[model samples]
Target: MKVKLYMATKSAKQQASIIGLLFAIVCFMSCQRSSNNLGVTENMEKDKTDVAEKIVLTDEEWKRRLTPEQYRILRQKGTERAFTNEMKHLGKGSFVCAGCESELFVSDTKYDSGCGWPSFYDTVDKNNITQELDSSFSMKRIEVLCSRCGGHLGHIFNDGPQPTGLRYCINGGAIKFQKDDEDNK
Candidate 1:
């Protein structure tokens, strides 16, 4: 009787351990799936509204309006090589969307993040840009886009200087720098 009781108790404990592990795994997977689904749904809704308000261009029109490099980054959501873009060193200029030429970032908000991209603490206006949750490359990021044309600009991060503590890390190929008149003096 004693031997049987001991064996039964051990078996119950093992079953409990297995149940706990399985529960944990299920919870983790559920949370991941929910979050990913939420991001997709939210972006879809936002994009629908944004598309209604902005210029809707066909692929041929976009290809004609943008240069090859600009089209890659803006229309195709491609990233430019780090440290190879001239916009990173631009001074006293306003950066406009390469797709629609809408004003996006000002020189005053630009900062050197040393991340081989044009970093900004702020934008020309909140209405000029849209952010969507991007889960590409097996990582999650907030993707910035031009509000006027829905062009992919880059990603925004939280690690940045004071005031906003937000970094708008933009691809140079996605924007055009127009020097401020004062800078020419």
Candidate 2:
């Protein structure tokens, strides 16, 4: 997914300052990817800024935009019931971050696990996720974070549905889907 950074400015200094702030925010939010096949991290070059960034939503703003169930599950670390998430049958599109609407996963990476969740073989980037130890349902699991806004997206499992052997069990409320246009492809 693309990182969107909103910049409102009245002058060059203000624009530079905003850009700097955005840089710092992105740098802090971004995680470093290890060559050892670990997971994403929060480290990168000091000045590799690109132009794909769009405006990011504030916490309060997102809360207002999303339903209580969505906010609770995606932003507040809550979980939805199994076999109930709406993204299960989702196909042929890009899944953007619900909090910011950045394209996170393409349809090609999607796979079915019959585990009542949307699974992916890989992410748009290795540093696209943050790892956490989740012990909520009296069981331990690895929690996935959006890395950009530190939003809880879902979990990762080793026993995935297919060839990649990695299941990225994402929360339905955590993302927004943009179906790919065949003509565009």
Candidate 3:
């Protein structure tokens, strides 16, 4: 009976060790994939400046220019609560970068993705935005930034409506709406 109990305990310990090893291996592989997709070996510095016509400001200047929440999302890459963003329901206007006021998405391109964020099928100009591979939270995503100010806008995904087949899931806090005057009249 004593021998059986000892063997059982040993088997449990071995199983736990195996599970732990498998978890570690999974984590390692995930990280490896993320790293590979992050374009670490590429000339990221050169690529960053491809959209070089952008606004540059000091931290203090940005803080002064933006509200606390705006600074958090635009500068710190933070996301606002879905369905809570005021800009999600905006109509008939252009969405401009909160950091640099660069025209990003037009109203026609905006669509209800039902993903709790303001989704756009396209931007006003490709040069108005920049994309980088984000590997945060163990997820590989394409991060979109304001080319003018390099502020974090949000992520872009391939699953979107036709014409572009790209969904620009933008942070509402990262943009400000400019309504057409005719609509207001």
Q: Model 3: which ten-residue window has the lowest total lDDT? A: 38-47
RMSD per candidate (Å) reads: 13.2, 19.1, 8.9
* Candidate 3 lDDT over residue span 1-185, tens digit each: 99999999999999999998986666334323323334322323323444447678899999999999999999999977666787655669899998888899999999987666788999998768788878787677778888878899988776678997777888889999999888898
Global lDDT of each candidate: 0.78, 0.65, 0.78
TM-score of 2: 0.63
lDDT of 3: 0.78
Off by over 4 Å in 3: 1-52
- Highest lDDT among the candidates is held by which one? 3
Off by over 4 Å in 1: 1-53
TM-score against truth, every candidate: 0.71, 0.63, 0.72
Better-scoring candidate (lDDT), 2 or 3 = 3
